[model samples]
Target: MFMNIYPKAYISSLSDVKADYFKEKGIKGLILDLDNTIIPWKAAILQPEMADLLKGYQASGLNLCVVSNAFNRRVVGLLEPLGIPGVAWARKPRRKSFLKAMDILGTTPAETAVVGDQLFTDIWGGNRLGLYTVLVIPISKKEFFGTRFVRLLEKFVLNRLAKKGVIEIPE
Candidate 1:
């Protein structure tokens, strides 16, 4: 039961996971979370360095799509410049959006990965479809009020997972 929310890997940030690493894992496509996963919470700007990293991933032959709970304008505004498609208002931890993203990427579950900061949304959503899941530490301390409440529970779960050797939390 606990494994459902557990990610296959956890890292400090998106930049830590390299293109070559994804290639080695046979991941040809990625379903990325927007807000905290890509930019800081509620922020639309994608840093130049992050943009370069994303472009490099694309250059390395990985298809990318943004799956966000935010409205269309916000998701599209940020990703349009990067030529990345997105599914906004994605009610994740549900299969529909993830399936839609897979369709957009034209990749099977085995060939795709979902990267995000939240376990309840991104990780759970990806795991449901057997997609590789990578949980990144939230980029900033600032976040939604509801998310702040969930983070308290998320921390407890992470501690348990770490103690069980299911994942390693950095000190």
Candidate 2:
């Protein structure tokens, strides 16, 4: 039960995940969360460094798709410049949206990874499908009220997982 919510790996930031690392892991595609995972919750656009990093990932032949719970307009607007497809208003941790993302990328679960900051949404969804999961630190302290609530539960689970030697937490 706890393993379902634990990420396969934890990194300080999205930038910590290198393109070669993804390739080395046989990751052919990425299902990414927009808020916090990609950009700060309140950020209107992708940062310059993030854009470059994403471009590098793309150049390495990895397909990318954004799966965000935000409205269509917001998700589309941000991802358009990056040329990445997105499914907005995706109620995550649900298999439908994740399966749809894999379909969009034309990749199987084993060939893709779900990357995000939230455990319930990203890690649970990915692990449920047997897709690799990568957890990143939230970009900023600011976030939605509901996400703030989930973070509390996530903290407890993370602590337990760390104590059990199931996952590593950065110091």
Candidate 3:
């Protein structure tokens, strides 16, 4: 069960994420999942509110970076103008890419938080690496074929945790 596996998991929405939350939580860096967490999957354009949210984090002295499994240049290119460096092909659920992002941010796992929409990849990877893990509802329910399959598994895990009262679903 995800609860037995990772006891400190949290589920939230991108809009609900506030700079003060991170500050109060003592997070100095953030490893953000680009695809549905920051923008809709396969969408090249960033929403204005999303951009403002990222800016808010930056303004609060928090280091932020996109850590995505996306390998396409087009997908990676979209984030360049945001003025933050990113690590594409992150291969999440694997620790190497998370470590690389941490190295780039010049922070340790203790001082970092990983925010993403997927439970298996993002949350698992972050928790395994000892970073605070936050799971956000995907911006869009539509997903790629492979991602849809992973989401099925993620839902199973979430359900199990919820039944055990270890994971609370956000309102």
Candidate 4:
């Protein structure tokens, strides 16, 4: 169960991700979590740095799609100008939305990766689908109420993974 929830990589933020690294790993597509992963939770604006990075990834030939639990309006508001496709109210940790994102990318699991701030949703869901998972620290402390509860459990799991050397926790 723990292995199933473990992420392939853990990083401070999305800015750490490099298109070249994914290319080397044969990942042609990216399934991204929108809220706290790309922007602050519930934020409609995409930061200039993040926007540039995402554009850079596209320029590097990586297909990208946002799979978000937020409402359709929220997702559309943020991604439309960028011309990125997305699915809203994804109910992730479930495989359906993840599969749908892959279909949109036209890439198989072997050629895809998932990047998000949540372990239960993003990491576990992506791992279940056999896609590489990269867990990033949430961009802000603000999030859904339910997510706060999940974060408690996530902390425990992260600590355990760190002690077992499955991953090294950042100080």
Candidate 5:
């Protein structure tokens, strides 16, 4: 478990995620988390910035879909205008949702990347399924109590990586 594994992982800010970066990394498809990753958890509407960014990625020929654990219809509604179909009640960390997203995108595991803000749900699930994983800092620190607890573990992992120089915290 302490193996110095080569990272099929990366940490990035939401603002720093670019189409070119994905293209350069040879990622042909993206599986995105909805809440906190694209918008704050409480937000029912997609921010214009996120809409534009999604358009940019789509325009670059990157297949994109929102894969979220949220079962809310409002969450699914928000993604429709972006013309990207989404899967809610994704039940992530379970492999089923990730596999479903890949099926929708028509891409295999090697061609896909999963982008989200949580470690337990997003990273663990993606890594398990053999898709490249990107862990973004949550847009808002406030979350459900259970999520807050998982976040504590996330910070522990991040801190350990920082201390080892395996990952550098942004200035």
Candidate 6:
């Protein structure tokens, strides 16, 4: 289970992602998590730096799809202007929604990357579908009660993986 949740790379933030490396590896699509991954939980829009990075990535020819567990209105309102496709209430660690996002992005799992701050949801779901998984530190410590609970489990898994020398990145 721990191995299944191990991310290919752990970085401080989305900006740390080496887009060229993923592009070189044939990753052509991005399955993005909207909240802590792109902005703080209550943030209304993307941060300027984040917006710049995402726009740059898109301009590089990679398609992006937002796959978040947030309500449809929340995700849709945020991604609408970008015209990015998305799936909301996308129960993660489940294959269906992830698969749907990939399909909408027109890429197979092998050619896609899933980016988020959670191990159980983003990493597990992406790894389950054979997509490259990238884990970024959450933008803020604030979280809902359920996510706070999951974060405890995520910490345990991350600690174990670190002890096993799997998570070597400095984040």
Best by TM-score: 1
Show where candidate 3 strays beyond 4 Å: 1-7, 168-171
Per-residue lDDT tens digits of candidate 2, residues 1-171? 555788988878988777878788899999999999999985899999999989999998999999998899999999999899999989998889999999999999999999999988888989999998988889998976777778888878777886888885433
Candidate 2: global Cα-lDDT?
A: 0.88
Candidate numbers sorted by lDDT from highest down = 1, 4, 2, 6, 3, 5
lDDT to native, each model: 0.91, 0.88, 0.80, 0.90, 0.80, 0.86
Estimated TM-score for each candidate: 0.94, 0.91, 0.87, 0.92, 0.89, 0.89
Question: Which segments of candidate 1 are over 4 A away from where they belong?
Answer: 1-3, 168-171
lDDT score, candidate 1, position 54:
97
Q: Write the per-residue lDDT of candidate 6 for residues 1-171, one digit (tens) a residue.
A: 455888987778888765686798799999999889998986888777887888889988888999998889888888887788879999998999999998899998899999999998899899998998988889988888778888888788777887888874633
Model 1 lowest lDDT segment of ten: 162-171
lDDT per residue (tens digit) for residues 1-171 in model 4: 554888888788878768987899899999999988999987869999999999999999999999998899989989998999999999989999999999999999999999998888899999998998988889999877877888988888887887888973323
| Tens digit per residue, CA lDDT, model 1, 1-171 | 555998888889888778988888899999999988999988869999889999999999999999998999989999999999999999998899999999999999999999999999999999999999988989889976777888998889888887889974322
Off by over 4 Å in 6: 1-3, 168-171
Q: Model 3: which ten-residue window has the lowest total lDDT?
A: 1-10
Model 5 lDDT, full chain set: 0.80
Model 1 error, position 79 (Å)? 0.6
Give residue 73's lDDT in candidate 3 (0 to 100): 86
**Candidate 4: where are CA atoms >4 Å away?**
1-3, 168-171
Clashing pairs in 1: none
Q: Can you give the lDDT of residue 171 in candidate 2?
A: 37
Cα lDDT of model 5 by residue, 71-167, tens digit: 8586678887888979889888778989998999999898898888877778788888788788887887668887777778777878777678875
Off by over 4 Å in 5: 1-7, 167-171
Candidate 4: give the clashing pairs.
none
